[model samples]
Target: MSARKVGMMTEDELIHVIRAAVREEFSAAGMRVDAPADVDEARRDFMFLRRLRGWVDGTASKIGGAIILAVVSGIVWLIVVGAQAFFNKP
Candidate 1:
């Protein structure tokens, strides 16, 4: 069945149709449909959190690299200046 056709039905009508389907399925198998299966909402939430964590980790790593580069460049500049000062003739 198309989604549009299902959507056109009222909420009660939809529920009634679903119940009927379930009943028919259960009757065909000679089984009871009293208890439904449990859904894992936490799994979806955990995946969303994990993705955010990855993004934050990548951003932090990039920022840390930039900081290390800036510090190393400054140290190199200081060493070059000190060497030039101490080695040049008076």
Candidate 2:
């Protein structure tokens, strides 16, 4: 789905879409997806693998953000060091 379409959906609709997509993905992977009737029910369960895909997806975004920040910071540092060297030269 497009980001614009998802952005226009209500909270409940978005939840349903996301849940269905996750179920489809799990089914494709040959994993048994036993989704609860509602998200609250899923949260109540104590299964280790439940919501693992969501956890991994969130973690991957966080890692990507961190890498982007690090790369930008390095570029900024190089620019600053080069500026200082140019200013200090005879």
Candidate 3:
């Protein structure tokens, strides 16, 4: 294996070398990689995911609330029925 000298490269030169090496490796392996160039596109993606999560959470909370309300209403109805049956008998 060949040896490389340490700290011999400037920052820009080092960056260029690293980018070239990555490009060559990817090209040799026949892979395609793309990076987003626009900040707006990334922001829109983040917002969409946030809205989707909020929608899911809101729907779940509504369903849970409705279930609890139904159970409480059913229990109240049964209690009313029992009270009427006991009090109206005499």
| lDDT tens digits, residue span 16-64, model 3 | 8888788667657664333454345556767999999999999999999
TM-score of model 3 vs. true structure:
0.57
Q: Is candidate 1 or candidate 2 better by lDDT?
A: 1
TM per candidate comes to 0.49, 0.46, 0.57
lDDT of 1 at 52: 99
lDDT of 2 by residue, 1-90 (tens): 556532477989989988889988866866545744444444555354557767999999999999999999999999999999999999
lDDT of each: 0.79, 0.77, 0.81
Error of 3 at 79 (Å): 0.4
| Residue 78, model 3, lDDT | 99
Residue 24 lDDT, candidate 3, scale 0-100? 68
Better of 2 and 3 by TM-score: 3
Query: Which tens-of-lDDT digit does each residue in 1-90 have in candidate 1?
Result: 556543488889989988989877866866555544311443565688999999999999999999999999999999999999999959
Error of 1 at 36 (Å): 8.9
